[model samples]
Target: MIEIKNLKKVYAGATVVNVPQLEIKKGESIGLVGNNGAGKTTLFRMILDLIRPESGEVLSNGYNVAGAEAWKNYTASYLDEGFLIDYLTPEEYFYFIGGLHQQNRAQVDETLLGLTDFFNGEILKKGKYIRDLSKGNQCKVGVGSCLLQKPELLMLDEPFANIDPSTQFRLKNILKTENKNNGVTTIVSSHDLNHVTDVCDRILLMEKGVIIKDIATSSSTLSELEEYFGVGQIVTPEIKVDKEENH
Candidate 1:
């Protein structure tokens, strides 16, 4: 449902993102993996049209993202806490978003009820502005908001980073259901290898602002990724020779 071509972004004389071409089909779950400065977030921003690419374009349903508003109707994304309305309470923010989507308060409540398990009893009636919540709780709020939208295309960045293990598990299940049962096209960028691999059908390994490997998920995908990231490699110390003594 999404296509990227000749996409490139640069910062301060350095190339940060340089994707030549990529495509994401409907109902597919894609995982983007990379270290810091790999340009994963940059790529995401370009897709969302939050940042204009220096060259090339992103297309959603064959319409250029840079030139269309139709894609926003079906896309939901939460990249960081910056996406939250920090001054508003979680409930208020959710209701506002719901209103924008033409969902009444009752509708919003019903949708939120379905996410009770995902919220883990920490979100609703918190009696605090979103800014006051902990980082993990804020992440929960962000993700929860995305679900309330019932988007056709969902994109999240580092979603597993701040949440607890149980919440992470719940989120993974939610993603799986959204992709498999609901046919949502999902693209998630994460540093958590295990979680990403478990939820995504395909993995894109990126480095130095380029996609280096794109692998279909399989029994061996995790180990292959770990090996690429040097998870289990052995390192031997270098030995020094006494050249003068030998002479």
Candidate 2:
């Protein structure tokens, strides 16, 4: 569970993020969707206490997230590759992260067993540093590291990006299972409407740093979002060549 009240962030005389009041309950799967410069990432950073808010604060359970270290025990986030220790191999990096949560090497290895499908046989024993792996593989490592903690709160930014379609579906199953079976409070941000709707029970539509729409997933939700996105949108034409030209 998380709470935000009058949260605001300003940069160069511009207000980037402004959330009036929001509360996510335990076992809720929430998704944030917005275009570029929409402040989704900013909101996430504020929640993680990575950025200082100009006005209000984020609270995890009953404790303030910014000043208290208690939330770290129950929180795990993977916003980007920066979260990974690039110099370390994926195995090393995972063990290191697991250690922080009081997980020994064997425990960490056991936890990794469930994640083998997500790893797709390319992650473990690859003998390659995380930085040397492809972007998608690196993403797998980051996600695996987060899940290893088994935190009460899990936050991921653009989790499906760069991952292949098959792997994306697998990741969705993992998140959904964790939320349903373990009651993990999950929050994720993505640009793909279909994917977000499929994974999250609730979705928030953001624009210009404001949460313009918050709705539970339904039969009509996707259509509503598609309609809204299509409004005021223009399609620029691209040059095309005939099939016979090459021949």
lDDT of each: 0.89, 0.87
Model 1 has an lDDT value of 0.89
Q: Tell me, what's the RMSD of every candidate?
A: 9.5, 9.7
| TM-scores vs. true structure, each candidate | 0.93, 0.93
> Once superposed on the true structure, which residue ranges of model 2 sit more than 4 Å away at CA?
233-247
Clashes of each: 0, 0
Scored by lDDT, the top model is 1
- Candidate 1 residues lying further than 4 Å off, grouped into runs, are 231-247
